[model samples]
Target: MLVNIELENAEDFVFIKQLLEKIKGVKSVCVKEEEEFYEDGTPKWFIDKLADYADSLEEKDMISKKDFFKFIDEEICRLNSQK
Candidate 1:
C-alpha cells in the first residue's frame, strides 16, 4: 500500500519512527521505490516474464527474489533505524 507521509520540520522528518505504527496491521507488502528500483538495462525476457506474470498470477506465478531480498533488507533497517 502507498502512504503519503508528510513531513513539516526536522522533527517530522523522523517519520521513520512511526514505522511501527504504520506496519501495525498489514499483510504482504510489495514496496517498489522509484528512486531505488528503476533502471534501463533490463532484459527482454525479464520484462516479458513480469508482464506475463502480472496478467496471469494464478496460472503462472513469477516473482523477483533479488528485488524481494532488497526490499526486505530495507524494511528491516528502516524498522530498526540502524542506518
Candidate 2:
C-alpha cells in the first residue's frame, strides 16, 4: 500500500518518518522533495564572501571547538539584533 502525507514542519516529518519506519509492513518512507535534502540556491555575493573568509583562515587563527561555537552563537545574536 502507498500513502502520501504532508507534514506541517520538519519536526513533524522526522517524527512521522520514524514512526512509519517502525511499522512491520512498511518497506520505506521517503521524502518527495529533493530541495529539503539539498541546497537549492544561495546568493552569489554571500557565497563569494564565505569563500573569501574561508581562504583567510590561518592555522594561527584556529580556535577550540567550544570557542568556535561561541563565536557562531555571538554572530547569530549580533545579526538578529540588527533586524
lDDT tens string, model 2, 1-83? Answer: 89989776767887898899999999989896632322656656677778999999998988999999999999999999999
List residue ranges in candidate 2 displaced over 4 A: 34-83
Q: Tens digit of lDDT per residue, candidate 1, span 1-83?
A: 65654444546544654553577665433433333233686766677779987887662455588978999999998989965
Instruction: Pick the lDDT winner.
Output: 2
Every model's TM-score: 0.26, 0.38
Worst 10 residues of 1 by lDDT: 29-38
RMSD of 2: 15.5
TM-score result, candidate 1: 0.26
State each candidate's clash count.
0, 0
lDDT of 1 at 26: 52
